[model samples]
Target: MHAEGADAADDARAALLAATGAATLDDAVIIARGRPRLDGGEPAGPVWKVRSTRGLDQEVSRLAKSRGVSKSQILREAAAAYVEAS
Candidate 1:
């Protein structure tokens, strides 16, 4: 690695360790973006991706209009339906 790149990585590691040690439990977890699932339900399954924004918007809008719902809500429901179908 380049000297500057190595230095930057070292700096980032040092900062992370410092934050983990200095933070409260909740704050530290939040800082690390760590979300631990509980036993009341199974862990969330793997997330899928939508490739094209335009296609996604069109589909969501169509579903929303058919369902008489808002576009954003329709998008979410469509995604959930897809996951279930898969």
Candidate 2:
């Protein structure tokens, strides 16, 4: 059972790395951790919570890293664009 669980975890990790196009397991782990929040200063607005699927979250992480921006920034832009389109 333990070996099976370990194998499952390994498979999941591999899938995540592949989906995110990370070069290695360590890269995948770093992507999963995400960038640290900036210190000090109040937020511009009220905080809001968002939930997403694992696949979507991974893709967002990759996009944010490639663009040198925070995940929140990406989500905010996307939301603003959606509202504008609507």
Highest TM-score: which candidate? 2
Candidate 1 C-alpha error for residue 14, in Å: 0.2
lDDT tens per residue, model 2, 1-86: 69999999989988978865677777777666765553455455667897899999999988986765578989988988999999
Measured on C-alpha atoms, candidate 2 has an lDDT of: 0.78
Give each model a TM-score. 0.33, 0.51
For each candidate, what is the lDDT? 0.61, 0.78
Model 1 regions lying over 4 Å from their true place: 22-33, 40-86
Give the top-scoring candidate (lDDT).
2
The TM-score obtained by model 1 is 0.33
RMSD of 1: 12.9
Per-residue lDDT of 45 in model 1:
57
Let me know the TM-score candidate 2 reaches against the reference structure: 0.51
Error of 1 at 62 (Å): 54
